[model samples]
Target: MSTPARRFDTDVLVVGAGPAGLAAALHARARGLRVAVLDPRVAPIDKACGEGLMPGALAGLRGLGVTVTGQPIAGIRYLASGSCAEARFRAGPGAGVRRTDLAAALSTAAQDRGVQVHRATAGPVTQDADGVTVAGIRARYLIAADGLHSPVRRGLGLDAPVRGAPRWGLRRHFPVAPWTDLVEVHWSRHAEAYVTPVGPGQVGVAVLSGVRGSFDDHLAAFASLADRLAGVPGTPVRGAGPLRQRARRRVAGRVLLVGDAAGYVDALTGEGIAVALAGAAAAVDCLARDRPQEYEAAWTAATRRYRWLTAGLLAASRVTPVRRALVPAASALPAVFGGVVDALAGHSDGGRTTSARTRWHHLEGAR
Candidate 1:
């Protein structure tokens, strides 16, 4: 007798409960598809991040009927070597949300939409032409939003080698009122510190650097910022490492990768949430139309600006002189700086022209 074939329990199985996976689940459910999400962690997962949502990210969340409560961020401010350059968002203000708060909001929205959430790790991914299976659950398709070091992607043999020095991030929350509405980027010789207000009395500080050290060691590089936060009560440090991750391809058999799992250049531009949401929407759209192959091109188009711009800036930052002169250069050339900021904010023509709906329609028409 032949072995029995697995039956799909859900139309889509999303591996991971982070923003990307949850967003994919919600999108799939909205399209009338049965979706189930899996992750070992419980509700309201926390991670180390800058915690500043750009205008486009905020808009995407709102479109999903997810409301995140946090501080309103008006602009970006780059400070280095006693110089500062600021660029206010022209479209709208973003938000400074804590990771846990954002996760809770997404989770609540997913629950309200009737999307199933399973608190179990995806043990292994096995896929065929018909469907994929993981954690003993079978589904027509699998979305790997397992984040920077996604096991799903690795298991599928889609992991790509990343070149250059690896960078890491450390984040902590301080009990102090924000001094400015702008999300501050404090640049030092070997690291960059991001300060975003997550609440009326709470601010998050994340430091990114190629060199490994304690959070305090990284903070000490920014003398003025350290002084301001000195003696303030702070939450325990959280971290994520080797910020740059690459995938050989986003699709493998019946699986599609979204968010950081798809590929990541760096967090320097802070476009992670917006890009992840876009990728999630695109993945669901492609799956709904039975055109999973189209997802690769769509995701590439959606993240072109982020990948290029972030890669360029990251390369420049690796150089000592260029890193030291970044803020001063931006201050000197306000137009150029503002243009770059707007591009990263998802307001540029290349970044905003193709909406997820438009992509889906194009795919549908192609079919």
Candidate 2:
């Protein structure tokens, strides 16, 4: 009897069905690749996030055919003490949506695209010159979009230790009408609180800090924000931790890392979703060309500015005096502040054209 030929269950095995994973699968399918997505959890997954989508991010989702409802965000607002700087978006409008709502949209898109999504846990990823295997299924390629702590990256020895001061994110929802159309970042001594309206009658607040406490405790740092929520009940708090994470390399043989699994810094600017969607496009293109190794360079260019800008901003916030003056200084220079906010919102034409050193004083101290 002749030996049987080996076969892969799908052309690509996607481990993780989060936004990145789902985006990768959908994009791959659009290119006529057979894709299989697996996530241990069921649909409509929820994670702690700012849940504010920049205009580019919203455009990316619609381009992928994922339609999710959200409240329009006109701009960004930085508040501290009694001073605040406001920047109206010049490119387009971003939106604030609940994580569960975004998850549902992604899941529906993947299913509608005829992509195979499995609700099974992936264990022991193995890859070779021919194909990659997870559990018993095999495919020509694998995308490890398993988030901050990616198990597939660990399995392939690509996990890198994150080096930075520890920071975490905690978020809760209040059933109140939105006070503003812009996403608000209220800076305090040791924390940054983000308030975004997810619906006409619902607002989400996420706190990024190194402090440990209840949601109310974190809110105490911002008296004005706390006063707004006085006597108002909130949903259960959701949390994500040690915000910084890293991976050794984006590629390991036939496997490619996408999304947070690839690497991440603190969520200071609320650009995670936009960057991840862009990475998915690059990743799927690389896979199509049978050039997995080239993905490392692609990944770098896709995220170079984000990593640089976020790191620089986070570093500045760590200094006590600098944190105190950030909002006030930005308030004085509305044009300069608007440029930075526009850059973060994914609008190229609205960002700074000068070097970081040139604007250091503008962002360093208002006192």
| Per-model CA lDDT versus the true structure | 0.87, 0.85
> Which tens-of-lDDT digit does each residue in 164-245 have in candidate 1?
9999999999999999999999999999999999999989999999999999999999999999998987899999989999
Candidate 1 TM-score over all chains jointly? 0.93
- lDDT of each residue in 54-141, candidate 2, tens digit only: 9878877766767789999999999999998999888899999999999999998788768887889899987777888887888889
What are the TM-scores, per candidate, against the unseen true structure?
A: 0.93, 0.92
- Model 1 residue runs over 4 Å out of place are 1-7, 347-367
How good is model 2 by TM-score?
Answer: 0.92
